[model samples]
Target: MSRMILRALLCLPVLVAALAAAPSPARADALHVGLVIPQSGQFRLLGDHVREAFQVWDADNPGAFGDIVEGDDGCTPESGVDAAAAMIEAGVDIVVGFLCTESLAAALPILSNEKIPVMTLTVRADIIGEEAARLGWSFFRLAPRAGSEAEIAADAIYRFWADKPFALIEDGAISGRELVEAVRTRLEERSLKPNFVDNYRPGQATQPSLVRRLKAAGVSRVFVGGDRSDLAVIAAEAEHQGVALSFMGGDALHAPEGELPLPDGTMAVLASGVVPGPEAEAARQAFAAHDMIAEGLRIPAYAAAEIIGAAANRSDYGQTNLVDLLTGTPFSTALGPVTFDATGERQEPGFVLAILEDGKFRRLSVDDASRLTGESQ
Candidate 1:
């Protein structure tokens, strides 16, 4: 078996042990979890998915939570603070949902002041991540910090395009530029640098000039920091001119297919959330039972419930420090094993490489990644 697979197997039993720490009276003293998600806003559908996952988990394990207090964050600052206050007033043992950074920013301090630990399923931003440590807040993030996405994209490119002449191009937008800069910096740190670097206007119909420039630079491999549409246009232009180029992109490529289909062998760097492991497959099966697709924060919300409820059991049902247990233990979920570093950031295996095969991106293992040769035009 693969080392990761074996490690996953070992982690499962530890989680099973922790969740089973408390016995059948579990239904009586189960943790009172406060569900804080945006129930009345634009992102309400996302919150609904989280709630459904929680319901599924609750039904699957009858004694996991004694009661669930609903708090509507509305994905806004005012609502987040209101929700936090409401949960505190309700005497919730723990809070377990926050979808947006605005909500976390507004509510974490209040929750922390009350000594209530939060397990945020999403809400990953650099400022929030810094504040959590600088202010000593009591929330653990299952989602990765913002810049890690760029770092993961760089890792994938360096893995497959190390020796090949590769171009790092970006759309002129701030976020796209920042992404390319981050990727460039990471690769340069490892003594690898792109052969060509340039900025192209986003939302262009075609990128013939950019394709020709890349061809002139003698680059066959490219890492794009742009929207899905721009990347698709670039690839289409490259093929139209019969230029042999292989493109790698970040998560923006996960959007709905555009007018021009992404050519085969196009790769994307995705968070491990999308990585289909044995654990994730089981979650998918369960989600299928509920007719849910397990996208975005949905599965993570379910995993958060598993971690928090099981952590309460690991503790003396509130006698032990919940943060200490969460920080110190490696909890397993249908998504995979969850462990965090001292900074409260998740550890390695945070991202996976995915390849566009037959019009869809499929997650790849580390070994699966190393064997790839850049796709021929």
Candidate 2:
């Protein structure tokens, strides 16, 4: 009896090994995520960076996130529609990455009908406003809407010149005019008014008259609602005409293609990229390992994937549950805490105040502001 018991105990080790080697029934039913970005054509370079970022996220996470499906929109409207349709047919739980604006426009109807959720990294102004009004839910964005950028510009100006007099200027272009008005609207809410307001014609070699008028008005600071070229011309002419005043504007001032160098201490409002926090530094190293630069859509794409994976992990791995999880809860990412309103727009969206020095954007310290205030301080 003792010999027989010993043999049985030895057989128990083999049985346990076999069971451990076998796959669990639940392991076969893993969830899936779809990455829909441009993989070819003009924007393929950006798509490559996005893909590498996703891969970096995946490598760190391993199998906890399940399968990652790829869909190439080719950075075109037609391709985006087709890519979204294919992802749906393939049975992906959620979709992320829409770098192309037109592609997002075309793919929405298809994705919406199936009730599939999408987290886009595109930064077009109308996506959450006009587009959301029509599309309703099942769509969210990682980047701030373009229209909100103007409000950020206003906020930065207000914070910097709270006790000083300033003027609002535009270049007669629709975008420039709208930006100027947006800043004016924000300022009015605070019971503050611009000391002077003016609109100048664009593409002039110089704006000596406008500069002289601004100087004569005793304006020591000016906010220009125009691109860097117009700002360059105005600043150069202002300096030449002996008018000493600081300049601030929208993100256009950050453009490296300025015809003239922007003056030192010139400030602009731009959407904040992944701020220089601990998470951002970690991502920087991860991106470097893959021989890629972390910029533009890369950080957003990685954050979008993290958002989807987190929502899925919190749910029963069903598409419906995942959608509810995304809309109802906030996901903290490298970019910051991301929460969406009912219409799929980020709540409390704001912009960063970046100062231009030697043609580079140096972010300024500012407090986060409510979306209503239109600035993150």
Candidate 3:
């Protein structure tokens, strides 16, 4: 009897070893994440930056958690839906990316139905506050809302140039209209009305007539709601026409200092959720070790990776409860302490006012414009 029992026990150990070597049930540890971006098209530059940022994060923290499934959305709704479906088939835990608002709107239904969370890098405010709520909790944004920055810009203008006449030039896009409206509302709240408000088509060949109108209006301070390219062109034209207006620009102006050319004494402000400083520099160094540059949408992408890493690290390793960790837990990133509100917006301040001096954007105090724009401080 003892010999028979010994043989049975030996057989049990072999059976267990065989089972362990074979396939097991899939769990959260095997889950992957999908990164959907415009890897090919007009927005490719932004997408490459985001990709490089994630690559750097993954390299710095091996086996941190989740595999990245790449999907090219091409900045279109149709492509975004296709990408989301592919990610679902691949069993990704979350979907991140979509630098364009239209693409985000296109992918929303699929991700919401699948209960997959998305962290958009775009700053379109209406999409998150209105669309996401109507759709579901599966949507979140790390980028600052559009209206918030506009409001901040208006406040800066009001506080700085209370005595000077101001003008607004918008590109007539959705973002442009929103910015113009928000700034208008903010100015109204302070009983300040702009001297002129006009919408111009972006990328138009000749803005000479527009410049002439602006000069005729006697507009001194100009608020531009457009991308860097359009803003630069307008600035050049304004300079040529000898319009001595102090320009204020959106976060799009926060490109590498010399990337855009502006006239001497052209002061501008940049509104963004994250400001590149010491913490950003440290993160950049870490990213460079893996041959990556942190810029554009890359900062938010890196922030998302950091947030995920923090959540995974805090949980018992290999555990399956990700939603709980992400929703309830707070994480500290190179940007700052990050905590998502119920709506998935990062509960933090937005906008870092910058000044154009000596052909570079220097971080300035909120009141710096008033002192600089004034005849005598």
Candidate 4:
């Protein structure tokens, strides 16, 4: 062959070999995340918040390798199991959402069987941590448990009114009962006993009589386990009875400005995993950049996404190994830092105290309250 032809022929074979050895165009891998929440019932608002959070994160980081599949569990055990089966069949590698404990309990077995990692936003403390550890590395939580809230409330109570006799009240529901027991246990550990413990059915109109009974008990500090409306009613009744009581509970009491009907001198403490501050505001900005509104469940939902993303990123988007990622990696998100212990429980601390002022819940300074009662923060 001529010199130029020979050179061209050699280059053509080398180019062809290079083309054959090169990898195909990188196709975007879809990381399907299952969102198991109530979307058509009373818990629809919570579901909306969760979905908004996920949407916000997805928008900020477009094509970041994750998509959510809605699993409408309807806050029921049977529905939750059905939702889990559906998500598994749809090839979801990880699951998030489930505001109810009963639904989570029902869904756990199916998720475990499918080896799908679940990041629960529910506050049920007893379900996923040590319990799931015994089963496998398939469960996680972004929200602090109800028991942790109770414990934080107990600490806040000790700081606010260490010398005063207190009362523990529950609404007889699962969460309320658990909070009451948790606070009581912590009090006992400190060699203290509440002057009284009472249980009431929430939303009933008979709270006036209950307040009178609590007043008769001479309890100045009251820790009630219920929602904001229930606590507001109790606070109003206490005011009507001319009794001044300091009340505290979980983040359920946190409402927008001018929403709560608490009287003057009624101090409340709200326990939450995500403290609203600079970090939260930054997260809000990130979500807004994506044209999404930040809601109450936003932190937990994004934390779920980050948890999965961090795992995938570390593994270079390898296999659909969600359980392994959940077991091995700790995801730090906008809701402060998160690291799971051996029992699959997050070691993130919950917020301590927030008092009701001018119809709004204001975050209390631990220093001020601790000095008031000679307690350490």
Please provide TM-scores, in order, for all candidate models, with all chains considered together: 0.88, 0.81, 0.76, 0.77
Q: Which window of 10 residues has the lowest lDDT sum in candidate 3?
A: 266-275
Which regions of candidate 1 are displaced past 4 Å?
A: 1-28, 373-377
> Model 4's lDDT to the true fold?
0.72
Give the alpha carbon lDDT tens digit for every residue of 1-377 in model 4: 89999999989989999999999755436578788877787788888878877777776666655567888867778887888889889888788887887788788878878777777886566645667877774677767755677678777666565678788898888777877798788978888788989998888643888898898999887888777778878887777788987777766666643344666444554544334544467667877787665666776677777766676565344654555556545567766567776566777655546666566555666554655566321
The full ranking of all candidates by lDDT, starting with the best, is 1, 2, 3, 4
**Residue 224 deviation, candidate 2, in Å?**
1.7
Poorly placed runs, candidate 2 (over 4 Å)? 1-31, 74-76, 133-135, 257-259, 274-279, 315-320, 357-359, 366-377
Best of the candidates, TM-score: 1
- List clashing residue pairs in candidate 1: none
lDDT of each: 0.81, 0.75, 0.73, 0.72
- In the order shown, the candidates' Cα RMSDs to the true structure are 9.3, 6.6, 9.0, 7.1
* Per-residue lDDT of model 2, residues 203-266, tens digit only: 8888889998898889888999888888888899988988888888886665666567888767
Residue pairs in candidate 2 whose N, alpha carbon or C atoms collide under 3 angstroms: none
For the record, the alpha-carbon RMSD of candidate 1 to the native fold, in angstroms, is 9.3
Which of candidates 2 and 4 is the stronger one according to lDDT? 2
- The Cα RMSD in angstroms, rounded to one decimal, for candidate 4 relative to the true structure is 7.1
When summed lDDT is taken over every stretch of 10 residues in candidate 2, the lowest stretch is 368-377
Candidate 3, residue 354: lDDT: 71
Q: Provide the lowest-lDDT 10-residue window in model 1.
A: 368-377
lDDT of 3 by residue, 100-178 (tens): 7777778877887887888887745655557676656577777766666876788778877667777888999877787
Candidate 4, pairs of clashing residues:
none
